[model samples]
Target: MSDQHQASASVSAARALPQLGAWVPGYVLRIAYAVTAAIAALLQFPLGSWLYLALLVALVGALRPRTLAPWFFLAMTGLSMLWAPPNTHSAAFFALLALGHLTHVFAARMLAVPARARLQLRSLARPLLHFAVIQATTQLLAVLVAVLLPGSSGASAVPLIGVIAALALLALAFVLITPLLRHERRDERR
Candidate 1:
Protein backbone atom coordinates (compact mmCIF):
# COMPACT_ATOMS: atom_id res chain seq x y z
CA MET A 1 0.00 0.00 0.00
CA SER A 2 1.04 3.56 -0.55
CA ASP A 3 2.16 5.75 2.37
CA GLN A 4 -1.07 7.70 2.02
CA HIS A 5 -3.20 4.59 2.43
CA GLN A 6 -1.15 3.36 5.38
CA ALA A 7 -1.51 6.70 7.12
CA SER A 8 -5.23 6.63 6.48
CA ALA A 9 -5.49 3.19 8.06
CA SER A 10 -3.58 4.32 11.13
CA VAL A 11 -5.86 7.33 11.47
CA SER A 12 -8.92 5.17 11.16
CA ALA A 13 -7.73 2.81 13.88
CA ALA A 14 -6.77 5.67 16.16
CA ARG A 15 -10.11 7.35 15.60
CA ALA A 16 -11.85 4.14 16.54
CA LEU A 17 -10.19 3.70 19.94
CA PRO A 18 -12.79 5.56 21.98
CA GLN A 19 -15.64 3.96 20.10
CA LEU A 20 -14.03 0.61 20.77
CA GLY A 21 -14.15 1.33 24.49
CA ALA A 22 -17.96 1.31 24.27
CA TRP A 23 -17.88 -2.49 24.30
CA VAL A 24 -16.46 -2.44 27.83
CA PRO A 25 -19.54 -0.88 29.39
CA GLY A 26 -21.61 -4.03 29.21
CA TYR A 27 -18.71 -6.27 30.18
CA VAL A 28 -18.55 -4.44 33.49
CA LEU A 29 -22.14 -5.44 34.16
CA ARG A 30 -21.43 -9.03 33.20
CA ILE A 31 -18.41 -9.23 35.46
CA ALA A 32 -20.33 -7.61 38.30
CA TYR A 33 -23.17 -10.09 37.90
CA ALA A 34 -20.65 -12.90 38.06
CA VAL A 35 -19.27 -11.47 41.26
CA THR A 36 -22.75 -11.12 42.71
CA ALA A 37 -23.66 -14.67 41.80
CA ALA A 38 -20.50 -15.88 43.49
CA ILE A 39 -21.59 -14.00 46.57
CA ALA A 40 -25.05 -15.53 46.28
CA ALA A 41 -23.61 -19.02 45.91
CA LEU A 42 -21.51 -18.57 49.03
CA LEU A 43 -24.68 -17.41 50.76
CA GLN A 44 -26.30 -20.68 49.62
CA PHE A 45 -28.98 -19.21 47.41
CA PRO A 46 -29.25 -21.80 44.65
CA LEU A 47 -31.28 -19.50 42.43
CA GLY A 48 -28.93 -16.61 42.87
CA SER A 49 -26.03 -18.85 41.96
CA TRP A 50 -27.50 -19.23 38.48
CA LEU A 51 -27.44 -15.52 37.79
CA TYR A 52 -23.93 -15.73 36.42
CA LEU A 53 -25.00 -18.48 34.06
CA ALA A 54 -27.68 -16.19 32.68
CA LEU A 55 -25.07 -13.50 32.30
CA LEU A 56 -22.78 -15.85 30.37
CA VAL A 57 -25.56 -16.65 27.96
CA ALA A 58 -26.19 -12.96 27.56
CA LEU A 59 -22.52 -12.36 26.76
CA VAL A 60 -22.51 -15.12 24.20
CA GLY A 61 -25.60 -13.66 22.62
CA ALA A 62 -23.99 -10.27 22.46
CA LEU A 63 -20.84 -11.69 20.90
CA ARG A 64 -22.53 -13.90 18.31
CA PRO A 65 -26.29 -13.59 18.23
CA ARG A 66 -26.83 -15.69 15.12
CA THR A 67 -25.17 -18.65 16.79
CA LEU A 68 -26.08 -17.99 20.41
CA ALA A 69 -29.55 -16.42 20.61
CA PRO A 70 -31.38 -19.70 21.03
CA TRP A 71 -28.79 -20.91 23.48
CA PHE A 72 -29.08 -17.67 25.39
CA PHE A 73 -32.83 -18.02 25.68
CA LEU A 74 -32.57 -21.59 26.86
CA ALA A 75 -29.91 -20.75 29.41
CA MET A 76 -31.87 -17.81 30.68
CA THR A 77 -34.99 -19.91 31.11
CA GLY A 78 -33.13 -22.69 32.86
CA LEU A 79 -31.49 -20.24 35.24
CA SER A 80 -34.77 -18.48 35.94
CA MET A 81 -36.29 -21.78 37.00
CA LEU A 82 -34.19 -21.73 40.15
CA TRP A 83 -35.25 -18.23 41.24
CA ALA A 84 -38.55 -16.89 42.50
CA PRO A 85 -40.61 -14.38 40.49
CA PRO A 86 -38.87 -11.39 42.08
CA ASN A 87 -35.48 -12.88 41.40
CA THR A 88 -36.30 -13.18 37.72
CA HIS A 89 -36.14 -9.43 37.53
CA SER A 90 -32.39 -9.85 37.29
CA ALA A 91 -32.86 -11.51 33.91
CA ALA A 92 -34.65 -8.49 32.54
CA PHE A 93 -31.95 -6.23 33.90
CA PHE A 94 -29.26 -8.34 32.26
CA ALA A 95 -31.05 -8.32 28.92
CA LEU A 96 -31.54 -4.57 29.00
CA LEU A 97 -27.94 -4.03 30.01
CA ALA A 98 -26.81 -6.11 27.07
CA LEU A 99 -29.08 -4.20 24.74
CA GLY A 100 -27.74 -0.87 25.99
CA HIS A 101 -24.17 -1.94 25.30
CA LEU A 102 -25.09 -3.28 21.90
CA THR A 103 -26.61 0.06 21.08
CA HIS A 104 -23.36 1.68 22.10
CA VAL A 105 -21.51 -0.68 19.80
CA PHE A 106 -23.69 0.39 16.90
CA ALA A 107 -23.12 4.01 17.79
CA ALA A 108 -19.38 3.42 17.75
CA ARG A 109 -19.59 1.84 14.31
CA MET A 110 -21.52 4.81 13.06
CA LEU A 111 -18.85 7.12 14.35
CA ALA A 112 -16.18 5.04 12.64
CA VAL A 113 -17.79 4.85 9.22
CA PRO A 114 -16.80 8.23 7.86
CA ALA A 115 -13.32 7.80 9.22
CA ARG A 116 -12.95 4.42 7.61
CA ALA A 117 -13.95 5.80 4.24
CA ARG A 118 -12.01 9.01 4.39
CA LEU A 119 -8.29 8.96 3.73
CA GLN A 120 -7.60 12.10 5.74
CA LEU A 121 -6.42 12.00 9.32
CA ARG A 122 -7.98 15.40 9.91
CA SER A 123 -11.37 14.06 8.94
CA LEU A 124 -11.08 11.28 11.51
CA ALA A 125 -10.07 13.60 14.36
CA ARG A 126 -13.52 15.10 14.67
CA PRO A 127 -15.28 11.74 14.76
CA LEU A 128 -12.88 10.66 17.50
CA LEU A 129 -14.18 13.57 19.54
CA HIS A 130 -17.74 12.36 19.05
CA PHE A 131 -16.73 8.89 20.20
CA ALA A 132 -15.51 10.35 23.48
CA VAL A 133 -18.78 12.29 23.81
CA ILE A 134 -20.83 9.12 23.42
CA GLN A 135 -18.70 7.30 25.99
CA ALA A 136 -19.07 10.17 28.46
CA THR A 137 -22.84 10.23 28.03
CA THR A 138 -23.24 6.52 28.65
CA GLN A 139 -20.81 6.58 31.58
CA LEU A 140 -22.82 9.37 33.16
CA LEU A 141 -25.92 7.27 32.70
CA ALA A 142 -24.09 4.32 34.26
CA VAL A 143 -23.27 6.37 37.32
CA LEU A 144 -26.85 7.59 37.53
CA VAL A 145 -28.26 4.09 37.29
CA ALA A 146 -25.93 2.84 39.97
CA VAL A 147 -27.02 5.63 42.26
CA LEU A 148 -30.75 5.30 41.60
CA LEU A 149 -30.97 1.56 41.93
CA PRO A 150 -31.33 0.28 45.47
CA GLY A 151 -28.70 -2.20 46.71
CA SER A 152 -26.25 -1.29 43.96
CA SER A 153 -23.44 -0.99 46.50
CA GLY A 154 -23.02 2.64 45.48
CA ALA A 155 -20.12 4.28 43.63
CA SER A 156 -16.70 4.23 45.20
CA ALA A 157 -13.04 4.44 44.28
CA VAL A 158 -12.95 0.69 43.90
CA PRO A 159 -15.95 0.54 41.57
CA LEU A 160 -14.46 3.35 39.54
CA ILE A 161 -11.34 1.27 39.11
CA GLY A 162 -13.51 -1.66 38.13
CA VAL A 163 -15.14 0.50 35.51
CA ILE A 164 -11.74 1.46 34.13
CA ALA A 165 -10.60 -2.14 34.02
CA ALA A 166 -13.84 -3.27 32.38
CA LEU A 167 -13.55 -0.52 29.79
CA ALA A 168 -10.03 -1.58 28.93
CA LEU A 169 -11.04 -5.19 28.40
CA LEU A 170 -14.03 -4.05 26.38
CA ALA A 171 -11.91 -1.79 24.23
CA LEU A 172 -9.54 -4.64 23.44
CA ALA A 173 -12.40 -6.92 22.51
CA PHE A 174 -14.00 -4.31 20.27
CA VAL A 175 -10.76 -3.48 18.51
CA LEU A 176 -10.13 -7.12 17.75
CA ILE A 177 -13.66 -8.23 16.84
CA THR A 178 -15.45 -5.29 15.30
CA PRO A 179 -13.36 -4.99 12.16
CA LEU A 180 -14.08 -8.59 11.21
CA LEU A 181 -17.80 -8.25 11.92
CA ARG A 182 -18.02 -5.01 10.02
CA HIS A 183 -16.15 -6.38 7.07
CA GLU A 184 -18.36 -9.44 6.91
CA ARG A 185 -21.56 -7.42 7.20
CA ARG A 186 -20.46 -5.07 4.50
CA ASP A 187 -19.47 -7.92 2.25
CA GLU A 188 -22.87 -9.51 2.73
CA ARG A 189 -24.67 -6.27 1.97
CA ARG A 190 -22.67 -5.76 -1.18
Candidate 2:
Protein backbone atom coordinates (compact mmCIF):
# COMPACT_ATOMS: atom_id res chain seq x y z
CA MET A 1 0.00 0.00 0.00
CA SER A 2 1.05 3.63 -0.53
CA ASP A 3 2.06 5.73 2.50
CA GLN A 4 -1.26 7.62 2.51
CA HIS A 5 -3.25 4.41 2.32
CA GLN A 6 -1.26 2.89 5.18
CA ALA A 7 -1.80 5.95 7.35
CA SER A 8 -5.53 5.97 6.56
CA ALA A 9 -5.82 2.30 7.43
CA SER A 10 -3.99 2.89 10.69
CA VAL A 11 -6.33 5.75 11.58
CA SER A 12 -9.39 3.61 10.89
CA ALA A 13 -7.95 0.86 13.04
CA ALA A 14 -7.27 3.29 15.89
CA ARG A 15 -10.88 4.50 15.80
CA ALA A 16 -12.12 0.94 15.99
CA LEU A 17 -10.13 0.25 19.18
CA PRO A 18 -12.32 2.45 21.38
CA GLN A 19 -15.40 0.76 20.01
CA LEU A 20 -13.98 -2.58 21.00
CA GLY A 21 -12.90 -1.27 24.38
CA ALA A 22 -16.32 0.05 25.28
CA TRP A 23 -17.75 -1.93 28.21
CA VAL A 24 -21.15 -3.54 27.87
CA PRO A 25 -23.86 -1.32 29.35
CA GLY A 26 -25.67 -4.36 30.76
CA TYR A 27 -22.72 -5.43 32.83
CA VAL A 28 -22.19 -1.94 34.16
CA LEU A 29 -25.90 -1.74 34.93
CA ARG A 30 -25.79 -5.06 36.76
CA ILE A 31 -22.92 -3.93 38.94
CA ALA A 32 -24.61 -0.60 39.54
CA TYR A 33 -27.84 -2.33 40.51
CA ALA A 34 -26.05 -4.54 42.98
CA VAL A 35 -24.16 -1.65 44.50
CA THR A 36 -27.32 0.42 44.81
CA ALA A 37 -29.09 -2.47 46.50
CA ALA A 38 -26.28 -3.02 48.90
CA ILE A 39 -26.26 0.64 49.83
CA ALA A 40 -29.99 0.66 50.44
CA ALA A 41 -29.83 -2.48 52.56
CA LEU A 42 -27.10 -1.00 54.69
CA LEU A 43 -28.74 2.42 55.10
CA GLN A 44 -31.90 1.16 56.87
CA PHE A 45 -33.81 4.42 56.77
CA PRO A 46 -37.31 5.50 55.75
CA LEU A 47 -36.48 5.29 52.05
CA GLY A 48 -34.05 2.42 52.53
CA SER A 49 -36.84 -0.11 52.97
CA TRP A 50 -38.17 0.56 49.49
CA LEU A 51 -34.78 1.08 47.82
CA TYR A 52 -33.22 -2.07 49.23
CA LEU A 53 -36.21 -4.19 48.25
CA ALA A 54 -36.14 -2.80 44.69
CA LEU A 55 -32.41 -3.50 44.30
CA LEU A 56 -32.73 -7.06 45.54
CA VAL A 57 -35.60 -7.76 43.14
CA ALA A 58 -33.66 -6.23 40.23
CA LEU A 59 -30.71 -8.50 40.99
CA VAL A 60 -32.96 -11.55 40.87
CA GLY A 61 -34.51 -10.54 37.57
CA ALA A 62 -31.07 -9.93 36.06
CA LEU A 63 -30.06 -13.47 36.97
CA ARG A 64 -33.29 -15.08 35.69
CA PRO A 65 -35.65 -13.51 33.16
CA ARG A 66 -38.20 -16.26 32.42
CA THR A 67 -38.78 -17.01 36.08
CA LEU A 68 -41.45 -14.30 36.21
CA ALA A 69 -44.30 -13.61 33.78
CA PRO A 70 -45.43 -10.46 31.95
CA TRP A 71 -43.89 -8.20 34.66
CA PHE A 72 -47.45 -7.99 36.02
CA PHE A 73 -46.21 -7.95 39.55
CA LEU A 74 -44.57 -4.61 38.81
CA ALA A 75 -47.74 -3.18 37.38
CA MET A 76 -49.77 -4.48 40.27
CA THR A 77 -47.47 -2.90 42.83
CA GLY A 78 -47.62 0.43 41.04
CA LEU A 79 -51.38 0.35 40.61
CA SER A 80 -52.06 -0.97 44.07
CA MET A 81 -49.98 1.72 45.70
CA LEU A 82 -51.96 4.26 43.73
CA TRP A 83 -55.40 2.79 44.46
CA ALA A 84 -55.25 0.67 47.58
CA PRO A 85 -56.02 2.00 51.01
CA PRO A 86 -53.31 2.05 53.64
CA ASN A 87 -52.87 -0.39 56.50
CA THR A 88 -50.27 -1.25 59.13
CA HIS A 89 -47.58 -3.94 58.77
CA SER A 90 -48.17 -4.57 55.05
CA ALA A 91 -45.26 -6.83 54.17
CA ALA A 92 -47.05 -7.90 50.99
CA PHE A 93 -46.84 -4.43 49.51
CA PHE A 94 -43.08 -4.35 50.00
CA ALA A 95 -42.72 -7.83 48.51
CA LEU A 96 -44.64 -6.77 45.43
CA LEU A 97 -42.42 -3.73 45.06
CA ALA A 98 -39.36 -5.96 45.16
CA LEU A 99 -40.77 -8.27 42.49
CA GLY A 100 -41.64 -5.33 40.29
CA HIS A 101 -38.10 -3.96 40.55
CA LEU A 102 -36.60 -7.30 39.55
CA THR A 103 -38.70 -7.63 36.41
CA HIS A 104 -38.12 -4.05 35.41
CA VAL A 105 -34.32 -4.35 35.59
CA PHE A 106 -34.37 -7.67 33.79
CA ALA A 107 -36.34 -6.18 30.91
CA ALA A 108 -33.94 -3.26 30.52
CA ARG A 109 -30.92 -5.55 30.59
CA MET A 110 -32.41 -7.85 28.01
CA LEU A 111 -33.09 -4.96 25.62
CA ALA A 112 -29.87 -2.97 25.98
CA VAL A 113 -26.71 -3.59 23.98
CA PRO A 114 -23.49 -4.77 25.57
CA ALA A 115 -21.32 -1.98 26.94
CA ARG A 116 -18.12 -0.72 25.22
CA ALA A 117 -19.85 -0.68 21.83
CA ARG A 118 -20.27 2.72 20.19
CA LEU A 119 -24.04 2.34 20.03
CA GLN A 120 -24.58 1.59 23.70
CA LEU A 121 -25.35 5.21 24.58
CA ARG A 122 -28.22 5.37 22.14
CA SER A 123 -29.53 2.02 23.30
CA LEU A 124 -29.42 3.04 26.97
CA ALA A 125 -31.24 6.32 26.37
CA ARG A 126 -34.55 4.85 25.21
CA PRO A 127 -35.22 2.70 28.27
CA LEU A 128 -34.43 5.58 30.61
CA LEU A 129 -36.75 7.85 28.64
CA HIS A 130 -39.54 5.30 28.64
CA PHE A 131 -39.25 4.78 32.38
CA ALA A 132 -39.32 8.53 33.03
CA VAL A 133 -42.44 8.88 30.99
CA ILE A 134 -44.16 5.95 32.68
CA GLN A 135 -43.33 7.22 36.16
CA ALA A 136 -44.44 10.77 35.43
CA THR A 137 -47.67 9.54 33.84
CA THR A 138 -48.40 7.14 36.68
CA GLN A 139 -47.76 9.77 39.32
CA LEU A 140 -50.02 12.27 37.55
CA LEU A 141 -52.72 9.67 37.13
CA ALA A 142 -52.47 8.56 40.74
CA VAL A 143 -52.76 12.10 41.97
CA LEU A 144 -55.72 12.73 39.71
CA VAL A 145 -57.41 9.55 40.84
CA ALA A 146 -56.81 10.24 44.46
CA VAL A 147 -58.29 13.70 44.07
CA LEU A 148 -61.30 12.58 42.05
CA LEU A 149 -62.11 9.36 43.90
CA PRO A 150 -64.08 9.38 47.13
CA GLY A 151 -62.04 8.72 50.21
CA SER A 152 -62.99 8.20 53.85
CA SER A 153 -60.04 10.12 55.34
CA GLY A 154 -56.49 11.45 54.73
CA ALA A 155 -57.05 11.51 50.98
CA SER A 156 -54.19 13.86 50.17
CA ALA A 157 -51.56 11.51 51.55
CA VAL A 158 -52.62 8.43 49.61
CA PRO A 159 -51.72 9.68 46.14
CA LEU A 160 -48.55 11.32 47.37
CA ILE A 161 -47.33 7.98 48.65
CA GLY A 162 -48.51 6.35 45.44
CA VAL A 163 -46.47 8.81 43.39
CA ILE A 164 -43.41 7.93 45.45
CA ALA A 165 -44.01 4.25 44.78
CA ALA A 166 -44.54 4.96 41.11
CA LEU A 167 -41.25 6.88 40.96
CA ALA A 168 -39.39 3.92 42.46
CA LEU A 169 -41.02 1.56 39.97
CA LEU A 170 -40.15 3.92 37.16
CA ALA A 171 -36.50 4.03 38.19
CA LEU A 172 -36.34 0.24 38.43
CA ALA A 173 -38.07 -0.29 35.09
CA PHE A 174 -35.82 2.14 33.22
CA VAL A 175 -32.61 0.54 34.45
CA LEU A 176 -33.81 -2.90 33.29
CA ILE A 177 -35.70 -2.03 30.13
CA THR A 178 -33.37 0.54 28.54
CA PRO A 179 -30.62 -1.97 27.81
CA LEU A 180 -32.98 -4.50 26.29
CA LEU A 181 -34.84 -2.08 24.04
CA ARG A 182 -31.61 -0.70 22.63
CA HIS A 183 -30.43 -4.16 21.68
CA GLU A 184 -33.75 -5.03 20.07
CA ARG A 185 -33.74 -1.98 17.85
CA ARG A 186 -30.14 -2.56 16.91
CA ASP A 187 -30.97 -6.12 15.92
CA GLU A 188 -33.86 -4.95 13.75
CA ARG A 189 -31.66 -2.41 12.01
CA ARG A 190 -29.09 -5.09 11.34
Candidate 3:
Protein backbone atom coordinates (compact mmCIF):
# COMPACT_ATOMS: atom_id res chain seq x y z
CA MET A 1 0.00 0.00 0.00
CA SER A 2 1.10 3.59 -0.58
CA ASP A 3 2.20 5.77 2.36
CA GLN A 4 -1.03 7.81 2.39
CA HIS A 5 -3.14 4.63 2.19
CA GLN A 6 -1.25 3.08 5.14
CA ALA A 7 -1.71 6.19 7.29
CA SER A 8 -5.44 6.34 6.50
CA ALA A 9 -5.95 2.68 7.37
CA SER A 10 -4.15 3.09 10.69
CA VAL A 11 -6.31 6.08 11.59
CA SER A 12 -9.47 4.11 10.79
CA ALA A 13 -8.31 1.23 12.96
CA ALA A 14 -7.62 3.55 15.85
CA ARG A 15 -11.04 5.14 15.46
CA ALA A 16 -12.69 1.75 15.74
CA LEU A 17 -11.43 1.27 19.29
CA PRO A 18 -12.88 3.05 22.29
CA GLN A 19 -10.94 5.03 24.87
CA LEU A 20 -10.52 3.76 28.45
CA GLY A 21 -13.06 6.17 29.88
CA ALA A 22 -15.66 4.62 27.63
CA TRP A 23 -16.04 1.94 30.27
CA VAL A 24 -16.16 4.32 33.23
CA PRO A 25 -19.94 4.62 33.38
CA GLY A 26 -20.39 0.88 33.43
CA TYR A 27 -17.73 0.46 36.11
CA VAL A 28 -19.14 3.19 38.31
CA LEU A 29 -22.69 1.87 38.02
CA ARG A 30 -21.53 -1.59 39.03
CA ILE A 31 -19.65 -0.19 42.00
CA ALA A 32 -22.74 1.75 42.99
CA TYR A 33 -24.67 -1.50 42.94
CA ALA A 34 -22.04 -3.17 45.13
CA VAL A 35 -22.14 -0.34 47.64
CA THR A 36 -25.91 -0.45 47.79
CA ALA A 37 -25.76 -4.17 48.31
CA ALA A 38 -23.30 -3.74 51.18
CA ILE A 39 -25.60 -1.21 52.81
CA ALA A 40 -28.53 -3.60 52.51
CA ALA A 41 -26.44 -6.41 53.88
CA LEU A 42 -25.37 -4.31 56.85
CA LEU A 43 -29.04 -3.46 57.43
CA GLN A 44 -29.85 -7.16 57.39
CA PHE A 45 -32.89 -6.95 55.20
CA PRO A 46 -35.10 -10.02 55.16
CA LEU A 47 -35.19 -12.03 51.96
CA GLY A 48 -38.41 -11.58 50.05
CA SER A 49 -39.97 -11.85 46.57
CA TRP A 50 -37.42 -9.34 45.36
CA LEU A 51 -35.01 -12.14 44.61
CA TYR A 52 -36.93 -12.98 41.45
CA LEU A 53 -36.92 -9.38 40.40
CA ALA A 54 -33.16 -9.35 40.75
CA LEU A 55 -32.85 -12.36 38.51
CA LEU A 56 -35.05 -10.94 35.79
CA VAL A 57 -33.24 -7.61 35.79
CA ALA A 58 -29.91 -9.32 35.67
CA LEU A 59 -31.02 -11.35 32.68
CA VAL A 60 -32.10 -8.24 30.89
CA GLY A 61 -28.80 -6.54 31.71
CA ALA A 62 -26.83 -9.44 30.35
CA LEU A 63 -28.80 -9.53 27.14
CA ARG A 64 -28.82 -5.85 26.37
CA PRO A 65 -25.99 -3.80 24.83
CA ARG A 66 -24.13 -0.62 25.77
CA THR A 67 -25.56 1.81 28.37
CA LEU A 68 -28.71 -0.18 28.99
CA ALA A 69 -26.74 -3.02 30.44
CA PRO A 70 -25.39 -0.99 33.32
CA TRP A 71 -28.80 0.44 34.18
CA PHE A 72 -30.35 -2.99 34.14
CA PHE A 73 -27.44 -4.37 36.11
CA LEU A 74 -27.83 -1.64 38.68
CA ALA A 75 -31.53 -2.36 38.99
CA MET A 76 -30.85 -6.03 39.42
CA THR A 77 -28.21 -5.40 42.06
CA GLY A 78 -30.43 -2.98 43.94
CA LEU A 79 -33.21 -5.51 43.93
CA SER A 80 -30.89 -8.24 45.15
CA MET A 81 -29.95 -6.13 48.16
CA LEU A 82 -33.51 -6.36 49.42
CA TRP A 83 -33.07 -10.13 49.57
CA ALA A 84 -30.09 -10.17 51.91
CA PRO A 85 -30.31 -12.52 54.86
CA PRO A 86 -31.77 -11.25 58.11
CA ASN A 87 -28.31 -11.49 59.65
CA THR A 88 -25.97 -10.38 56.91
CA HIS A 89 -22.39 -11.65 57.19
CA SER A 90 -19.45 -9.48 56.27
CA ALA A 91 -17.64 -12.31 54.49
CA ALA A 92 -20.67 -13.12 52.38
CA PHE A 93 -21.20 -9.47 51.47
CA PHE A 94 -17.57 -9.03 50.47
CA ALA A 95 -17.65 -12.20 48.43
CA LEU A 96 -20.77 -11.08 46.62
CA LEU A 97 -19.12 -7.74 45.86
CA ALA A 98 -16.05 -9.48 44.52
CA LEU A 99 -18.14 -11.57 42.16
CA GLY A 100 -20.06 -8.52 40.97
CA HIS A 101 -16.84 -6.56 40.39
CA LEU A 102 -15.43 -9.31 38.22
CA THR A 103 -18.64 -9.55 36.24
CA HIS A 104 -18.59 -5.81 35.55
CA VAL A 105 -14.93 -5.70 34.55
CA PHE A 106 -15.38 -8.54 32.10
CA ALA A 107 -18.45 -6.93 30.65
CA ALA A 108 -16.60 -3.68 29.99
CA ARG A 109 -14.99 -4.86 26.77
CA MET A 110 -18.08 -6.61 25.53
CA LEU A 111 -20.09 -3.49 26.17
CA ALA A 112 -17.61 -1.12 24.54
CA VAL A 113 -16.51 -3.15 21.56
CA PRO A 114 -19.17 -3.93 18.99
CA ALA A 115 -16.84 -5.43 16.43
CA ARG A 116 -14.89 -8.59 17.19
CA ALA A 117 -11.46 -7.84 18.66
CA ARG A 118 -8.82 -9.78 20.54
CA LEU A 119 -9.66 -9.48 24.24
CA GLN A 120 -6.51 -10.01 26.28
CA LEU A 121 -6.29 -10.93 29.95
CA ARG A 122 -3.84 -8.06 30.44
CA SER A 123 -6.39 -5.58 29.08
CA LEU A 124 -8.94 -6.75 31.65
CA ALA A 125 -6.52 -6.74 34.58
CA ARG A 126 -6.23 -2.98 35.00
CA PRO A 127 -9.93 -2.36 35.54
CA LEU A 128 -10.21 -5.25 37.94
CA LEU A 129 -7.25 -4.00 39.96
CA HIS A 130 -8.55 -0.44 39.98
CA PHE A 131 -11.98 -1.52 41.24
CA ALA A 132 -10.68 -3.90 43.88
CA VAL A 133 -8.26 -1.30 45.18
CA ILE A 134 -11.04 1.27 45.47
CA GLN A 135 -13.39 -1.08 47.29
CA ALA A 136 -10.71 -2.47 49.62
CA THR A 137 -9.49 0.98 50.56
CA THR A 138 -12.97 2.21 51.42
CA GLN A 139 -13.77 -0.98 53.31
CA LEU A 140 -10.70 -0.48 55.51
CA LEU A 141 -11.63 3.11 56.22
CA ALA A 142 -15.17 2.12 57.04
CA VAL A 143 -13.97 -0.56 59.43
CA LEU A 144 -11.65 1.86 61.16
CA VAL A 145 -14.39 4.41 61.66
CA ALA A 146 -16.78 1.75 62.82
CA VAL A 147 -14.35 0.47 65.41
CA LEU A 148 -13.19 3.82 66.74
CA LEU A 149 -16.51 5.64 66.91
CA PRO A 150 -18.45 3.28 69.11
CA GLY A 151 -20.23 6.13 70.83
CA SER A 152 -21.61 7.46 67.57
CA SER A 153 -24.53 5.11 67.86
CA GLY A 154 -25.48 1.63 68.90
CA ALA A 155 -25.29 -1.43 66.63
CA SER A 156 -27.90 0.18 64.36
CA ALA A 157 -25.38 2.71 63.07
CA VAL A 158 -23.15 0.25 61.26
CA PRO A 159 -24.80 0.52 57.87
CA LEU A 160 -25.25 4.25 58.01
CA ILE A 161 -21.68 4.90 59.10
CA GLY A 162 -20.16 2.55 56.58
CA VAL A 163 -22.21 3.88 53.70
CA ILE A 164 -21.24 7.44 54.54
CA ALA A 165 -17.55 6.61 54.71
CA ALA A 166 -17.62 4.59 51.51
CA LEU A 167 -19.49 7.25 49.62
CA ALA A 168 -16.97 9.86 50.70
CA LEU A 169 -14.14 7.64 49.54
CA LEU A 170 -15.88 7.03 46.21
CA ALA A 171 -16.21 10.76 45.67
CA LEU A 172 -12.50 11.15 46.26
CA ALA A 173 -11.70 8.36 43.82
CA PHE A 174 -13.65 10.06 41.05
CA VAL A 175 -11.70 13.26 41.60
CA LEU A 176 -8.39 11.43 41.48
CA ILE A 177 -9.31 9.36 38.45
CA THR A 178 -10.32 12.38 36.39
CA PRO A 179 -6.82 13.24 35.22
CA LEU A 180 -6.14 9.64 34.28
CA LEU A 181 -9.39 9.52 32.33
CA ARG A 182 -8.51 12.72 30.45
CA HIS A 183 -5.11 11.32 29.60
CA GLU A 184 -6.74 8.26 28.10
CA ARG A 185 -9.02 10.45 26.03
CA ARG A 186 -6.08 12.48 24.77
CA ASP A 187 -4.25 9.33 23.73
CA GLU A 188 -7.29 8.13 21.86
CA ARG A 189 -7.50 11.37 19.92
CA ARG A 190 -3.90 11.15 18.75
Please tell me which predicted candidate would have the highest lDDT against the true structure.
3
In terms of TM-score, which candidate is strongest?
3
Alpha-carbon local distance difference test for all models: 0.46, 0.52, 0.54
Collision count of model 1:
0
Candidate 3 lDDT, 82-185, residue by residue in tens:
33321223554455555555556545655664433444445657886898797797556545554665464223555565467569989999999999999999
Poorest 10 consecutive residues of model 1 by lDDT? 80-89
The residue pairs found clashing in candidate 1 are: none
User: Which pairs clash (backbone N, Cα, C closer than 3 Å) in model 3?
Assistant: none
Q: TM-score of model 3 relative to the true fold?
A: 0.50
| TM-score result, candidate 2 | 0.42
Q: Cα lDDT for residue 174, model 1?
A: 93
Relative to the unseen true structure, what is the C-alpha lDDT of residue 102 in candidate 3, on a scale of 0 to 100? 53
Steric clash count of candidate 2: 19
Q: What RMSD does model 2 have? A: 10.1
lDDT of 1 by residue, 30-123 (tens): 3333343333323322445455555454455444434544344343443343333222124343343343444333333333343123233344
| lDDT of each residue in 111-175, candidate 2, tens digit only | 45343423454555666776567656654544455456555443547667657766998999999
Which model, 1 or 3, shows the larger lDDT?
3
Ranking by TM-score: 3, 2, 1
